[model samples]
Target: MAEIKTSVTINATQEKVWDVISDIDNEPKFWKGTKEVRNISKNGNQISREITIAFRDQKCLQDVTIVPKETIKAVFTEGVIVGEKILTLKDMENSCELEALWDVKLSGKMGMFTGIIKKHIKSGTEQALQAIKEEVEN
Candidate 1:
């Protein structure tokens, strides 16, 4: 499993930041590699999203646990990865800080590209956080 953590501070309220991050439907707008988020199934606090990522040829379904502004945790049920990802938010004066922690385990044929996947996650996290910051601050 590869454990990656990245964070970014945005010039926006915690509420505003949460509003953008928590919206699972609009995630592709700020997230890197994500192409589309659909076939959403919600059960109280748990949500399952079928996502099409740019790096993958097929779409994958992942279960996500949402706690409003506090945290969002996700685990993939299908695709190249079979692990969990977590995103947390913190209050910092007038601005808000968002942290993303990813714990990814490769599955099947994708396992061979672990090194490439790790690099993708490392760079993608940085780019994604920056994109999120820009989207929220705009």
Candidate 2:
């Protein structure tokens, strides 16, 4: 399993940050790599959505587990390789720090071409972090 982790400190409260992150329907607006987010269903903290992600034109059906105001875990249930995203928010002094950890395992021909995909994923995460910072601060 390959993993990518990135973090950013936002000049906002944990609750403020959580408000933006918890909106499962607006992921495409804040996440640069996400082209669209279609809600499939939701039950409590668990949600199912179809996400069209940037690069390689990958469309994935992902199941997301959300812990309101604290954490969110998303696992790919269909398309491409198995992937998981874990997001955690921490309160620090007068600000909040958001950390995102992404783990993915490639399969078939896609497994052999992970170098290119990894770079895009990393860059996308960085952009997403920056977007989150802007949204939370403003």
Candidate 3:
């Protein structure tokens, strides 16, 4: 599996950072790799959704769990990719830290290009974190 992790320190409180990251509907705004999100169902802190990824506009089914101000975990259920992506938020005295962890691998014939895909995802994740930081700090 391709594993990627990236983090950013935002000049904002945990609440501010949480407000930005927890707004899952606005995910595509910061996550360039995510083209669109369609909510299929919701149960308390858990959600089932379909995400259209930028990789050839592939659609992936994900089961997501939200732990309020702590973390958001999305596990890929059915798609071209298989694995999980997690976003964690840590509160500092006056600032907050946001970290993203991705452990995934391409399915079927696309598995051969996992190395290339890893690089792309890593860059995209860094960009996404920066975008979130900018949004929260401002």
Identify the leading candidate in terms of lDDT: 3
Q: In candidate 3, how many clashes are counted?
A: 0
Q: Name every residue pair that clashes in candidate 2.
A: none
- The worst-scoring run of ten residues by lDDT in candidate 3 lies at 129-138
Q: Write model 2 residue lDDT over 23-85, tens digit each, in one string.
A: 878888877778888889989888898888775668899999998788999998888858798
lDDT of each: 0.85, 0.86, 0.95
Better structure of 2 and 3 per lDDT? 3
Candidate 3 residues lying further than 4 Å off, grouped into runs, are none
Who wins the TM-score comparison? 3
TM-score of 2: 0.94
Model 2, CA-based lDDT = 0.86
| Tens digits of per-residue lDDT for model 1, 21-66 | 8887887877767888885778898888898877855687899899
Minimal lDDT window, size 10, model 1: 52-61
Model 2 misplaced regions, further than 4 Å: none
lDDT of candidate model 1 versus the reference: 0.85
